[model samples]
Target: MRVVSLVPSLTEAVALTRPEVLVGATDWCTHPAGLDVARVGGSKYPDLARVLALRPDLVLLNEEENRRADADALLAAGVPVRVTFPRTVPEALTELADLAGALGATAEPDWLVAARRAWAALPEPGALRRAVVPVWRRPWVVLGSRTFAGDVLRRLGVANLYAEDAERYPRPDLAELRARRPELVVLPDEPYRFTADDGPESFPGVPCALVSGRHLTWYGPSLAEAPALLAAQLAQPG
Candidate 1:
């Protein structure tokens, strides 16, 4: 069946499923490398006209990266769209499994079993850590509660200082970080490009680590790598 993936993660899944079947994709769907498809556009503003011309049987989407009006337009045109939004890595694996099952695809990744086993072996943080998984530098968007980063950190025993805050990605003053004093700050490499060194300069003595944006923040095929990646981060000798 011909498929069009507007979301980067779902587009990656289509590539994982069968490259030949992916008739259309966005520019950022570059996971497998050499994913050759007409670059319709980015996730936020897909080339709706180009996508409609693809004559696809199914269009893949993600609630996080897609706009409500755009999806409504596709639905109005009588195209079947499947949406997936994973809060954690395991959920992403499940979504992949479900997508594969629906598409009659073979060779499902062993993420479901491995992810749980790896997560179970993870040690917990007994107290709060003043880490900021911020997405941007100027405006400062953080990895707040209800997101994959927050959930994974919570499971591993670390807590977000802004967990009690109202906004998910609130802009906080430097005083907040100083007040909470995170043991080891974690920053995502993408969106904000915040590195471990950036942490030391901003919040001195707070041993920090630049986290893989996809593993911690992305909720797609990348989820399969979360448990082990997180474990390695946690296992680092202080």
Candidate 2:
């Protein structure tokens, strides 16, 4: 089955699981190294014409990463679209398992099995560290309630300060962010590249953990190593 993936995580999952089935993917699908599929632009603003030209039997998207208008347009053009929205690690595994079933896999993919096992092995946290997770700067958008990233942090014993906010991605001013008094600032290197010099300076007294966005945010094969990898980064002295 020919597939076009607009979500990077789903693209990696599909590409790694069944590479030949993916005929097109967004430019942001940067995993598995040297993926040579047709680029359909970015996730939020994919080139619909290019996507249509691919003539894929199926198209993969995420409720958060993709626009509804794009999915509608694809459906309007008689293209089948599979949109996934996984808010927690278990949900992510379920989503991948569902996708695996769609790909005609009689058994769970090895990566999926490994991911399940890896996450299951994460030891319960002794104490939680309150943190502010900024996904973007300028306007300062942060991880809020009901986000996959927020849940990922929760699993790692880092509670998001804005997780109770109404918006999934809340745009709060810098002063307000600092006022929250997060014990740590968890910075991921995607959506915005928060380097050691870039993000840590903002939270003067607080420890800052520079992490891989793919491991922290993406819900694919990377899930297998996320627990240990993120733990090590979070363990750093900032």
Candidate 3:
């Protein structure tokens, strides 16, 4: 089956499992480097005409990574679209398993199996440390409540300072964020690249954990090593 994926993580999963099935993907789908598929623009605003032109049997998307208007447009054009939203590691694994089934896998793929084992092997945290996770700057947006990234950090023993906030992603002023007095600031390099030089300077007193956005946000094969990799980063001294 020909597939066009707008979600980067899903694109990686599908590409690694069944590369021939992917005929198109968003330019942001950077995994499996040297992927030679039609670029469908960005995940948020893909080129619908180019996507449609691919004549894919299935268009894969994530509710968080893609816009509803694009999904609706595809549906209106009589194209089949599979939308997924996995808010936690287990949910993400389940989504991948389901996708594997859709891809005609008789059993869970190696990466999926390893991911399940890796996450399951993580020991429960003794105490949860309070942290403020910034995904974007300028306007300053953070992981609030019910986010996949927040759940990932929770599993790693870090509690988001704004996890109780109503908004999934909240725009809080720098002063307000600083007033929270978090134990640490977890910075992932995506949506906005938070480098050691770029992000750590903002929080003078707080230690910052610069992490890989792919591990923190994406829900595909990265799940296998994310727990260990993120743990190492979170363990770094101030």
Residue 194 in candidate 2 has what lDDT? 91
Candidate 3 local lDDT, residue 181: 94
Q: Write the per-residue lDDT of candidate 3 for residues 1-238, one digit (tens) a residue.
A: 8999999999999998888899999988899889999998999999999999999889999898899999999999999999999988889999999999998878888999999999999999889999999999998999999999999999999999999999999999999989999999999999899998898898998889889899999999889889999999899935
Off by over 4 Å in 3: none
Best-fitting candidate, measured by TM-score?
3
Model 2 TM-score, all chains together: 0.97
- Superposed on all Cα atoms, the candidates' RMSDs to the truth, in angstroms, are 2.7, 1.0, 0.9
Select the stronger candidate by lDDT from 1 and 2: 2
User: Number of the top candidate by lDDT?
Assistant: 3
Which residue pairs overlap in candidate 1's backbone?
125-157, 130-182
lDDT of 2 by residue, 57-130 (tens): 99998998889999999999999999999999999999999998898777888899999998899888778999
lDDT of each: 0.72, 0.91, 0.92
Which order, best to worst by lDDT? 3, 2, 1
Candidate 2: Cα lDDT at 173: 92
Cα-based TM-score, every candidate: 0.85, 0.97, 0.98
The collision pairs in model 2 are none
1-238, model 1: which lDDT tens digit per residue? Answer: 8899987767776676666778998877777677788878888998899999999888888887888888899999999999887776467667878887777766674544455566667666566555665577665566665676788777765677777778767786667656766776777667567765554477676666666776676655566567678657754613
